[model samples]
Target: MHNDPSNENGILHSWQQNAEAWTNTVRDGLIESRRLVTDRAIVDAVLDGQPRSVLDLGCGEGWLVRALATRGIQAVGVDAVPALIARASERGGEFQVASYEDIAAGRLPLRVDALVCNFALLGKESAERLVASLPSLLSEDGRFVVQTVHPLVACGEQAYVDGWRQEGWTGFGTAFPSPAPWYFRTLASWVGLFAETGWHLCEMREPLHPETGRPASVIFILQRH
Candidate 1:
């Protein structure tokens, strides 16, 4: 499959195809990474900023939106995949079907106090374009928080570089198929991308897993002064 997200078999297409299975997997607690560590890590990171309104970019099934709602924080979930957004809407969240292209083009009408992208940035060009377009979508004091698989740990045997990586639905079940290849970015690249887009890295959190004590994900809290 082509590494570009615009391709028919790219990351967005794969998510659209497997939205149901992905929703089930998430709701069922089948993935140990989210079940144990990353999910709460992201939720807590978002809440810590105390934003009244939050935008969950690439939010799947609106889980985070629903979670934040319990605490009286208004949240909206947006994704490029219509199926995922539809599933999220069915779950009673404020969701809209909007691609990164749509967002980058300033189609989003509201500016949010906080924006969260949890393991959702998959393509190289999309990531950069999306980040570059975020300042206008955020309030003056808004924060952009992103949580991704720790690059150092996730790299494994692959050479450390920014390129297309063969996706491994590692430890996932047979129900999930046609896993799409994702762009692999180094930690430095992540920081560089943010910096180049006028975002200052305020805090970086590596939440540890209880069992292995390994950093499960890296959370970057970015701010613009």
Candidate 2:
């Protein structure tokens, strides 16, 4: 319904304005299923010995934070939207309204055991900067987990026009409707980004769709080197 195609910032503002409704709709349908498998995989990879501190970047509505808390980890959620932050705070985790770039500028107040970034970080520049800043925020041996739309699928080259039918969800979601260029990098590019940024790649897994059982995503787990 929102169609402002200026830049990444503009797209983000649009999301902020419509995020609650959009995310709720997503959660009630396809995203909720994908998240269950993705979140569990990330938690299993990073949450060891009841980590006392964790950080969720681009935390929308604090779902990840609340999930971590239920596992006994002290989690904090950060996002750029005030409405999302407010909703996140009411769910029991500490919420901060701050951009990822702003958070990267200053040292994190605590050495977090893990940092999880879900299907957030859409902008190329911001994603690069956040990826580069992870080493400083994570404790030694800490893990950084990320799950995003597969570049091969999101880029204009390949279209999943009919795959959604097989996967049981309507494929009406736009990959990049706005002019803000998304960094749909290949697997090598993704690995190189972290390697150049001082993080050691540990594991990379692509999960299959629940319905079609076809590979639908690429998930990465990295550790500070």
Candidate 3:
């Protein structure tokens, strides 16, 4: 949770090291909640808008990009981890290696009708900068969509106060690599973030697990104001 220079490096290192393991596990349906609920929520939100081209920020393993392709939507996937991007490239989609800072600085050269960040807005600094840059990243009428772990469920035993959180590798077994750091923000803070960025929250929904009835993730569909 420490906001030091090493934190970002640590996160990238962990993901890089764990890319193949993470990809293999996710592809094999290791996380049932994501496979069943959150994944569908993200795809449905984008399809409902019917965007011609989509930019998937921090798209891991290119699963979502592949899914979108099957639906006739062109998606460009970008991630900081080279290994993940490589795996994504092998999946037959346009994948790029760009950090969140690259996107914030307008270094990534592309524009799309919609941008999706699926469980990828990990840190406060990057998240803030990225939100501020969304106006330039999307088309005039494009939407910014993000699906994240529901604060209520994500908070679990931790304090609701916004801060750094080292992910628990418990669910992925020992084969998983280093734990990554992510910021935990309350629902109120999430709302405030978009509002400060001059983006309006046009739609919001909590994707719930059909069998357990527990919310898996929260989707926020936003528009430039």
Number of the predicted model whose TM-score against the real structure is largest: 3
Reference-based lDDT, each prediction:
0.87, 0.68, 0.89
| TM-score (all chains, Cα) for each model | 0.95, 0.80, 0.96
After TM-score superposition, the amount by which residue 222's alpha carbon in candidate 3 deviates from its true location, in angstroms, is 0.3
lDDT by residue (170-216, candidate 1, tens digit) is 67653876677688789999999999989999999999989999999
Winner on TM-score between 1 and 2 is: 1
6-93, model 2: which lDDT tens digit per residue?
Answer: 4446546655665565555544544544555666665665574246788888888887788788878888888888878886677577
Query: What digit string (tens of lDDT, one per residue) describes model 3 on residues 84-143?
Result: 999888869889999998999999889899999999998887789898997898998899
Q: Roughly what TM-score does model 1 have, to 2 decimal places?
A: 0.95
lDDT of 3 at 220: 95
Model 2 residue 6 CA deviation (Å) reads 5.1
Error of 3 at 162 (Å): 0.4
In model 3, where do residues sit more than 4 Å from their true spots?
A: none
**Candidate 1: C-alpha lDDT:** 0.87
Candidate with better lDDT, 2 vs 3? 3
lDDT of 3: 0.89
Which candidate order results from sorting by TM-score in descending order?
A: 3, 1, 2
